[model samples]
Target: MTETNPTKVQLVQVDPELEGQRIDNFLRTFLKGVPKSLIYRVLRKGEVRVNKKRVKPDYKLQAHDEVRIPPVKVAEPQELPSVKLNKVANLEQYILFEDDQLIAINKPSGMAVHGGSGLSFGVIEALRALRPEQKFLELVHRLDRDTSGCLLVAKRRSALKSLHEQLREKQVDKRYHALVSGHWPASRNKVKAALRKNILKSGERMVSVAEDGKESETRYRVLQSFEQATLVEAFPVTGRTHQIRVHCQYAGHCIGGDDKYNDEVFNLAMQEKGLHRLFLHAYSLSFMHPKTGERQTLIAPLDPQLSQVLKNLSHA
Candidate 1:
């Protein structure tokens, strides 16, 4: 696909490969370096049109549909730092499973799933750079920057659609291993609460339990216990934003090392025990194969640093 010059009012025709994609996403790819807010603004003002008619951001494009884009200033594409390039190249070592339809990686902690919020590059961008020959690769779902494990990517549009459908139908099973700050009661196995996402004035995102929030559920089982912390497996029944972290906090045991939703005292105590990052790991994922009808389960082992932290706590 040819790149669109943001300085000009450009008209482009959608091809079959991009037929089902939302118009806003299509424009993002076409007008690289244009801010997302600007794109939406153009759409709202009718500066962007499909088939000569105004369309919503969610409007799916059809093959051969003509899209009109208005002139807008866009930032120039900048070269990624060599350090980031090297880090992204090393991502090949983390691949857990890969096939024609999808790929799963034991994503390392501290890497964002996709770049945007102050990050210049992320896993998806790095993967694209690593495999420049591949025309289509997209994230199936997201993981927190500090969370590590079975992150999925789609190799085909059909696979992406199928996996998304499975997620919506709750056919996908995702489980995480988390270490919390308090002794989790044996009888408290399930947490049924509602969560609402809020943005702070500083633009930081947070989640809280609220009566008007979307319904969310999480199942927890204690795996091990220390004097100050407990290791538990969390199954989030509803994938609301920060569901697992906030749910654990609501249950009176905030996840250890979770700076956003955890007690600072607990975080400091855990930090003294060699825990430097959030003690949350996406341990396993199960779902039906997008291409095949059979069920597939993928797992990622805990990072060595996290394992060492647990080992230290056990001896303490």
Candidate 2:
């Protein structure tokens, strides 16, 4: 088997017992989990060398030939497999901001924020595919897949570190707009509950308000009202998992189409009206520039479908 931590090639003194094997086969004996196809590709690209000279995969092994290998780095971001964009074609107009230091995308519902849970691609993957020259793009923070809003990404490592620090210090300001079921009793409210992680059947982590849960705080105010539902602006004081959703639920109002923690009947009604996902949008974000320390704010208007739903509900 190949070396477990092989970053680059190293010379080895040949033992008489293994002298006559084919060079490729001999090399494969030391490497584990590496496929022959990849080995061949590396060889064809002149990444493998014997005695300081590039050699064919079929080259014969010599007793003491010094093998050289170019250092192996993780596959470049641009070279990753493409993420098809057919599903999100309508949401393309939501890119609210982009710059050398940051990228802000208005993510839509039914799309994942990042690749995990057997998913093959996500918005970041597609972005990397579109911009091949950028060597790094790191997520500064995350919003739920069903939560539409301004998602931030840093273009460089230093920027990522700085942005994360800002988030920890509560220096970034985030606002979300959500349409929730039931009329709220109060126009302004604050929910101060702790959130505890719950495990779902699929082994995914969920959140619930519990007495012993981590501290979370969410402030909300009514924006508009329909007959049975209301739109509210929410500002979370602490970045706890599912803080807004749990706090809203505790307030006797739940965001529409929040399947994970919402009223099923209400969710179904919204689905019938073609509102199949959560009615939550990350409406605004403000933070100091990671490099220059200048204040910047990004905003994303609601997706057209959500806006249309609001209009229909208003007419009702």
Candidate 3:
């Protein structure tokens, strides 16, 4: 069934030139915020019809076609809870890349990507306050709350659209560094798997391979290895949610200090060794500039906690 804010409106006159136009395309010009996926859902459910007939997405609409639009039920915009700016004193320290159209930050552990689950504010809201005149600040991609480094933000709508297209086209290159809990078998390995999301009783997102799931891919090479763990560089080819963390676990090497996805006992052991935060960091991102049309690569250095984890783990 389709879930959306349905619009209840009387039939409007269609131009003569609009006759025989596809319903989906015609609706695009009139609607705002309803995703194309939702539109297809509406068509399939017969909420939108053409000339008293159940029309599919490809169905043509003639002039004066009486289209019945279901009552619009749009999701309301979430209000951002207030935050005390003084608490986030080091928020400025994370900025690593900035331009008129974009900005990249070395996002630290303990800061969320957005306000939810009782979080008062995320970095985006803080950044938005920093530049109120810009009118929009959008997250081009996401990094886990406890994972540090290289989070990209788009300053304008056009840049966000272009960069998102690049991601879909597989033109964006992303590389990460992670310290995992076991010695990998190969110097380099590729993990190709399908991942499905299942909600745990505790309300956290849990992922595993399922027959019906999204395809995820990761390529890794051992950079440093020790008695019980290894430091590796990971390159993700697809942007599925928690793609890297889930893939690492599927490979039998959960990332050190990953509380949500990693083994709990192993995580506690790492915590004893001063590895308190998630030992994963986005190291580099390369893409073509949206406005300049030039190739660009941005890098964010490892934070102290992750660096120390490597230092202490390599010797053990």
Every model's TM-score:
0.83, 0.74, 0.74
Which candidate number would show the highest lDDT if scored against the true structure?
1
Cα-based lDDT at residue 122, candidate 1: 89
Q: Give the TM-score (vs. native) of candidate 2.
A: 0.74
Better of 1 and 2 by TM-score: 1
Writing each residue's lDDT as its tens digit, candidate 3 over 1-316 gives 3346544554656665466667897776455446788778888888776666788788877767777776655544444433446535466678998889899988888899787788878888777756658655889999888878888899865687789999999999999998888678775489999889888898888888776999888999888878778888999988787888988988889998887678787788788778888888899999999999999999999988777766776454
* TM-score winner: 1
Candidates 1 and 3, the one with greater lDDT: 1
lDDT of each: 0.89, 0.77, 0.80
Kindly give the number of clashing pairs for every candidate: 0, 5, 8
Report the C-alpha lDDT of model 2 over 1-316, residue by residue, as the tens digit: 2234446566665454345556677656544345677777888998778877888888876767777755543332223444346644433455677778878888877677777778776777666666669866768898987888899988875677788889999999999999888786564588888899898898987899899999899988888878768889999999987789888888878889887779877777777666777899999999999878999988888988898888778422
Q: Residue 275 error for model 2, in Å?
A: 1.7
Candidate ordering by lDDT (highest first): 1, 3, 2
Clashing pairs in 2: 1-29, 1-30, 1-31, 2-30, 2-31
* Candidate 2 C-alpha error for residue 199, in Å: 1.7
